[model samples]
Target chain A: MHEAITEEKWDIVIEPRSSLLSINWKEIWHYKDLLMLLVKRDFVAFYKQTILGPLWFFIQPLLTTAMYFLIFNKVANLTTDEVPPLLFYMAGVTCWNYFSETLTKTSDTFITNASIFGKVYFPRLVIPLSIVLSNLIRLAIQFSLFLLFWFYHLFVTGKISPHWELIWLFPFLIVLMAALGLGLGIIFSSLTTKYRDLRFLLTFGIQLLMFATPVVYPLSLASEKYKWLIAINPFTGIIETFRYIFLGKGDFNWIYLGYSCGTTVLILFAGIIIFNRVEKTFMDTV
Target chain B: MSGNAIEIRNLSKMYRLGEVGTGTLSHDLKRWWYKTRGKEDPFLKLGQENKRDTAGGDYVWALKDVSFDVKQGEVLGIIGKNGAGKSTLLKLLSRVTAPTTGTLKAKGRIASLLEVGTGFHPELTGRENIFLNGAILGMTKEEIKRKFDEIVDFAGVERYIDTPVKRYSSGMYVRLAFGVAAHLESEILIVDEVLAVGDAEFQDKCLGKMHDISSKEGRTVLFVSHNLAAIDRLCSKALLINRGKVVMENTPKKVIEEYSLTNYIPGEIIFEDNRFLKFLSLKQEGNNLKIVCDYDAPTPLEIPCLGFVISDSMGNKIFGTNPNYQPPKTPIKESAKGRLQIEILYPKLLNGRYNLSIWFGDGKVDYVVMENVLSIEIINMINYVRETYATASGPVSPIVEWKYDYKD
Candidate 1:
């Protein structure tokens, strides 16, 4: 009917698959406010009526660090490579908490948010990206708690020396952890949309995965027989590098860090592609 | 400028019926193989039209090759029976799901409110959710800030703005949610039955806002509602869909009329009495209301040359035929029981309820005359190009339209 004039430019064209790269950076940018609000909601909505409120963010890491310190260091005779037990365990628990939270929450993006997602159209990436970003607030809180313990170890006890020169590497390390968790999470979410068989497996898997990383005991305690499973794990390099820079006495290698970085980028890239493809039609399956 | 805000071409959506379990992996693999080989989808060929009553195969086309265009600033009402793909079409337009095939192109942004309070979290306060829902519906934070007061005032929930939405009454919640959606800054708005939510007063307010937005702001609107009166009043044009296909596209008045006629279920009206001769049944045949009667008359009677007249609601005879489209060659003799049938073929009597009067008459006397024997409704009968009823003399309300050429 509109054949008289030509050259129409439409803002949106919806079809089955919009190529392998179905992401629109501009659209995501426009929804940045939504991302910020959702992050705030996640941060604020959980602890509204609790007496301690956001203090639980700090309390949770403190309690886990205490439990791990007692079980692994005191009872099992595990060493922290000459670092303070409280500082080492707290640091491990803080960073590991952020990674696990991001991974688990992002892994179920399609299933948990099916109601809102089915009613409107927005860049679906805003969801997991916000989750990853919001958990950073918890990271900052728990990291400050670890920093207080770091100051006591450095000044009061003088028991451990730190690599202050490598302090600039800390932010990049957190970014690498986020990217790896997000990438793996979205891949699982996309695959599990039709068959949620993975949902039951994911919770137990994250618990076992923490042991694969060096969260409870330092990597030095791993025997030669079980080291490969711990070494190939990308979280090992992050934890070891984190220990090397802050506590000054654990395992850290450039090849290991570089390998982790490469794996993170590759998984994140693959995750984006799969997430983009699945988001278009996940409503039907979910 | 193509003067169209949206153009959908050959859009179709196929859904797998029943429980999808372990066997779906094979279907997915086969579909992928076909895609890699550059062949058409093998499953789309076997999909059945979406009909609720019929037993369908595994695949059903929720929407089948539906193509339509919406002009800029046009309010289009989509009316259809339940499970007739109305929701499917809106879901496609809203991008809630991708089509199995074909394309939908739209200029500017499209904000669809398939349901009110779509992303409204129960824990969030009203003010916070205003920004959240606004952003979810494609508004910028700055846009929401500028329109915040207007939204709150329009919803009339300013006093409860700081309270969590779960604490608010259901009416207040719907008002706030609809307020946020109505304030969305998009070029096209797609609303599906959301107006039926809230009180009657709030519904009128929402309708007024819709009218203002489409007319004053020159925004395109696609409305789907079972409220036919609302559709007729608001929409410039309407679409009637049945069984995954477009049945008609025309003005809202005509489409509504056609919708009634399309969904009408024919049944026998068995309420009549007679002196010695009585009636049997009356039902709708193809383009006619067929009347069948079994009579036991005291004496012989003439045939088809029976008197049949259909009167309008005003008690005036509208249209009828004496022979009722066909006459028998011979007269009826005295019989214990006899059969009589008449067809009111192509009775283009305008859409209204009417009563039928029947009587058996010859040249001199009348035999059996049953007055007001049946009442029936005629719908969508004015399909031709006739303009004779400009000034109807009888008691009637005629739909009117006027056009004029420009003058120097």
Candidate 2:
């Protein structure tokens, strides 16, 4: 066998299968154009043909916030601190929406993109990365709407003031939100490929997850005994951090925030490893 | 050696066939224990060939110990029957799926056009799809912009370039997809059965583009298709796969010859399983080759039983006859058998080895049995023939009838 191998132009050997994370990162980087196009496709095709078009981006968050205000603030007697109710809910909703949409879309990726993946080759990670990016555009539009509401409250009431010190932490909040959503999404996407039972469970699970986070009500409204519950949620830090910056209320617990940040990073790394492994062999199983 | 652009070595891909799911935790723990001890999987003993209706298995190798290198600027054709793992091999090379074992090293960017309208979005316009598909195939935005006009022009959908692709006819969609794929300037191009779409004119244009890509631009190409005629025309070299293994690799003529020989056989060739052979016809007329058949038996036989199988001197079946689709057929009666003769008229087959296998079978079960029955030699080297280009020799030349009228 050794002598025969020497005669061959390219030596051929069968090795034991290794994890797919061992794939060369340099190759994926070279395929970045495909990633960009997938992102562009998600952005354009999603809103292009609709009658409302890009306005749907703003309308979605605005309508969602209005519904929460009517249901949670007025009906359920949820506190919004001293900040205007509209401004308060819109800020929380925009950040929450980014994470929710990213997670929702990423979870469905294996099924939605199966036909393309089955036929051709591109970086499989490109699709999930595009989902995060496409959702960012929506977040930006909603963020602008939040800014408009903040200014209206500022001019009309002249009673509330946003904390300038908390503004320094905005970029960190974005990272925390994106990391948690993308990480959780990839994990769910990988699982759903095999046990399709998770697909139905995931839709119900995201709604439950919303109440666990401080999306509808501010984190300050929680009582002392249940404060531990808020700290345990990885999203607690992201939501609290956003409210602390915009509404100028909510305790800034650096220690819990650090804990949440650490969990987010760890989940992101683990998600990448699992996603890389699933991307290679998912075609066969899927 | 010869500036090889694509190099694949021992590229084996194993798949866990039948009910691929995450098993119970106990199974996982046992598998892990085996892996830790540096031993082969114990459950592997239970595995069976994918073709058989068998019980549970650890894994089955879809591709096993396959190795072949394709040179730069070479157009390599891969031909195989269904379940021969042709698509699996392409998917592995294109990185759509990973090989369970072995290594593949290829230089330069590789783009795969596995089907028509692969990256097209129905809501996006025809023009938008070209850019999207181009980008998916690895063309930069600027490159896509530069080639955009050529793609639209090639698809002949310029009038509806701005209209959403969903509105375009199926033919128009395929044309645009092929146009974008043809214009991709990657170092290697992998195309699989993409020529099966569009009208005849578009197919010709696609072939011309493929020829230009290989000959002029010198990109490596790997094409997989069942169309032997197209493979014979476009491919410089060929690989034949059977049952997930490479059987032969050589010039297109030689590979196709070996392939047709092994895989080609009449359904009725194997009779006595409640089958009786009834009819057979072989003839040559003009430059056109035609086949006609009439068969009947006591028991109802599956009509047009696996069509016709033609072989050569080496006992290799060169061709099989079957309708592309189930066209309307005249019904047959039990115990009724009739005679029908077929004539081949035309530009005679190029000089080569040839034979014929004709049978009327009930489904795969046969009535009339004939294996390597009829044979012919098309002699070449005629004196001062107007159409003579080379010495042509082969089995079966269809005789052509020509008539001329002159007035004095």
Give the number of the best model, judged by DockQ.
1
Alpha-carbon shift of residue A11 in model 2 (angstroms): 17
Chain B TM-score list for all models: 0.67, 0.70
- Against the true structure, candidate 1 reaches a TM-score of 0.81
Instruction: Give a tens-digit lDDT track for model 2, residues A39-97.
Output: 77787877775898878887888788889989998999888887778887888788889
List the global CA lDDT of all models. Answer: 0.83, 0.74
Instruction: Score chain B of candidate 2 by TM-score.
Output: 0.70
True contacts recovered per prediction: 0.85, 0.46
DockQ each:
0.61, 0.45
Runs off by more than 4 Å, candidate 1: A1-6, B264-408
The residue-by-residue lDDT of candidate 1 on B1-408, one tens digit each, is 438899999999999988768878889899999989999878989999887768968899999999999999999999887788999999999998999999999999999999998889889999999999999999999999999999999999988999999899999999999999999889999999997677667887898899998999999999998766678778999999888898899999899777765542222344345644555455544445677766665555444246677776558887666653544466445344567776656544443456778766442466667677666554433543532121123323356687878796
Candidate 1: which docking quality band?
A: medium
C-alpha RMSD between model 2 and the true structure: 7.7
What's the chain B TM-score of candidate 1?
0.67
**Which docking band does candidate 2 fall into?**
acceptable
Deviation of model 1 at A167, angstroms: 1.8
Which residue runs does candidate 2 get wrong by more than 4 Å?
Answer: A1-29, B21-29, B43-58, B264-268, B275-408
